[model samples]
Target: MSATRSALPRQALVFLAFGLVQLALDTAIYVGLTAAGLPVATGNVAGRIAGACLGFWLNGRYTFAEGGKTRLQRRHLLRFILAWCALTVMSTYLLASIVTGTSLQISWFAKPLVEAVMAAIGFVVWRQWVYR
Candidate 1:
């Protein structure tokens, strides 16, 4: 029990570290696409796709690698895509809603917050099921 408790924090820290990189990648692509006059949904999808690809490998290779042991398999990739798709849909809807309600500038500020919330949920899913 203690081991599991200890592992959670360490795993969370590593996950957060990798998540920052993913967030940055996602945001940059999102901003670039939106600035180019793409729709919010399109930009969000592009960004999430870019980030998700990198995130799967990083988390699988390090954060959730079962003490640096498990190599990523096809199963992990498939599971990751499923999870990513769901999360991306939610993210796109939220961003689109925000944009519809307010301005693109507001949506820009809201992007990180949206992704942060999504990341929190994603961490649990990845730890408990996706990577497991």
Candidate 2:
């Protein structure tokens, strides 16, 4: 049990890797959609939903390792949803404000950066409040 506990940090690294993969996938999808002339907001929302689902799956399966729980499981799922929603709104606003307010023509690239930050925030919140 002690050794198992000690392995958590390593497992966390794996979780982060999985998260990054999902993030990359989400970004690619969003960019592809936008390049295809889809509405930005539509692409954003669709990417968010897909990324949130993938995050939940990976975190539940690999990060927390509590996917089998019943009652507690439901609560974690709910918390994940709420947390994702909050982070999404914050990231979206931040990206939009930075892009429009700043003279940087590359502001569109800020979306993935914001998402990464929000994902880190969500991981901390989930670990402290939702998982344990």
lDDT of 2 at 92: 63
> What would the TM-score be for candidate 1 when compared with the true structure?
0.95
Q: Which segments of model 1 are wrong by more than 4 Å?
A: none
- The positional error of residue 28 in candidate 1, measured at the CA in angstroms, is 0.8
Error of 1 at 89 (Å): 0.5
lDDT of 2 at 36: 80
Give the runs in model 2 whose Cα sits over 4 Å from its true position.
1-8, 66-72, 102-105
> Which residue pairs in candidate 1 have backbone atoms (N, alpha carbon, C) closer than 3 angstroms, thus clashing?
none
Error of 1 at 88 (Å): 0.4
TM values, all candidates: 0.95, 0.79
Predicted candidate 2 versus true structure: per-residue lDDT over 47-77, tens digit per residue: 7888878878777776776435422478788
lDDT, candidate 2, at 23: 79
Task: Specify the poorest-scoring 10-residue window by lDDT in model 1.
Answer: 63-72
